[model samples]
Target: MTRSPVLELRGLSRRYGQTTVLNDIDVTIPEGSFTALLGASGCGKSTTLRIMAGLDRPSEGEVLLSGKDVSQKTTHQRNIAMVFQSYALYPHLTVFQNMALPLTMRHLSSLGRMPFVGAVAPGSSKARNLIAEKVGAAAEVLGLTDLLHRKPSSLSGGQKQRVALGRAMVRDPVLFLLDEPLSNLDARLRVKMRAELVALHRRTGRPFVYVTHDQSEAMAMADQIVVMIGGKVAQAGAPRDLYDRPASRDVATFIGHNAINLFQPADGMPGLHPAADEAVIGLRPEHLSPAATGALEANLETAEYLGSEIILALRSERGTEIRAIAPGDYAIPAPGSPVRLGFEPTRLHLFDEQTGKRLEVAS
Candidate 1:
């Protein structure tokens, strides 16, 4: 039997005046699963996250957590934690103070929160001790045990992010929302933190809704990916599923895990009509080859030398351009030389000319 989703967005949408920011969005996030909201800027990914966080309200829909509607609840009432791309750490607060804030507020009374009153308030010492224990454990897990006393300004970018994450962890939330959390880091640090963040998720066993515009980041980190465009959901699935079998020409071009080449039947390829009529032909660069005897004719345009492979650009007889990836050691023709390109009949993809949606054919 399949497990129920931990969270659900039912008929979610957001609109302003005549413009719709989000169009009938529906999503379900599984328990302990990492789901990425992937899209370009202004695709409403950040707006969707805000709706879930109660920072923004949906015009028509419910945000449900564990089957209960939390749409009307405040951010604190929803028991969710959020980490922003800015790291949002208080510069004056020590790592320990920042990470301990949530627990202290939850356990201490009003008087117990007063700077001096808290030192003398009854039972305040016990709450402080408990907060310390929680903060220490979180710091250890985040590899910040040695720097827990440092302020955010004194820390590195990755360190500040960890503190922000540490603050969220101490809350022990049921769900965590991250909005472009790694976007501010340098490329090298970003790669290292990606692995660390995934490990952190596994260690905590909490559900995550990560929002990012970077396709590579989503592909590398998310267990599931939701592709959004124009405030509407385009597709949601495992990273490889979207990569290998895109549902539309837009998805094909977007997943773009590799260079995707499109062609027309008029280019002289054989066995393609089932997928070519009023449909755009889709091909991965790896699926194309330069052969001695083939149906299609093209002129070599450019060859980019990647370490392990050569990416060749070509233009067909009808001026239809396509790209191909060849082995680094493969003999390459001159830029203007005429060439033959071949592809496996079974590997072609077809999409509707009008809708840009993928087409299916029976074997």
Candidate 2:
């Protein structure tokens, strides 16, 4: 069966007065897929989310939900739910009430919401019971059934986040747009929440468009990652694809650990075969080994022990510095000692220094 895209942004752009915050951006979020908009601050990821949520008007372009244009729809008409960085729960309301608010607003009137009369009003009892059932189910899924009576202020950070998720889930949204939902949590909690989010997406089988500046969050949660820079998409692909085969130096440096070793290629230096305009060579730390088998050798500058691994900072004879991580059990070469460095020919990444674009190396 052919699946339609859950969300699509066609020529999407946002402008504030004289400045353009998001340029003509176009993207397709696949159905039931968890896609992340990954970028640093001020890169327009949040603006893009607002546009998707119908909270912000775009200067150009349209937002399509299930192949229909929702750009002109109001926030309430979109049927899309958002979980913000701040939980945004009502301070006075208990978790149960908070989760039930959306349903109550949809089904009950002002006169029907009063305490004594509300319970007896025609159809109010049935509606209230239905809302209660939905809220209870959502709470169970979020593991918040135990904290149903607690107010937002009384619950811990992670618990409050579960309440927020439960609230959004109760709405039965077609799409979930999360804007750094885990940003307010502590480091360990953030990791825990990341796993929960992945599991939640799997359980719901819903399309989730998540926005976050944290690369680790994107790497760990997203099935597809859209890397943004200067209000435009720098690159978008699978996390492992982006890590192993970056399209540019910007992408390579931004997505992974270990600073890449960049060097100008001389006239055919052994395995250092150069591509067109290939002045820079990029190699991951694991690609560089101390074994004397490949094309280069460098003198060890220093080594730092990191429990399970050791980071070696080395300087090539021609002044190209590289960092390599080896197993902690491996004997680290002493500083100032010359050691041979080996790299797989296919593992070598060539880049055009001027443009920082990846160059295809000939096999």
lDDT to native, each model:
0.86, 0.85
Candidate 2 stretches with Cα past 4 Å from truth are: 114-117, 264-271
Off by over 4 Å in 1: 264-274
lDDT of 2 by residue, 1-363 (tens): 255788899999899999999999987898888999999999999999999999999999989988899888976788888898898999999999999998998888776798888888888988998999999999989889888888899899999888888888898888898989999999999898999999999988999999998888898999889999889888888899888888887887788767776666643234556452346777888777777675677789999899998888988776767787777787886789988777777777777878888888766
User: Where does candidate 2 clash, by residue pair?
Assistant: none
TM-score of 2: 0.93
Weakest lDDT window of 10 consecutive positions for candidate 2: 267-276
The model with the greatest TM-score is: 1
RMSD of each: 1.8, 2.2
**lDDT value for candidate 2?**
0.85
Poorest stretch of ten by lDDT in candidate 1: 268-277
Give candidate 1's root-mean-square deviation (CA, Å): 1.8
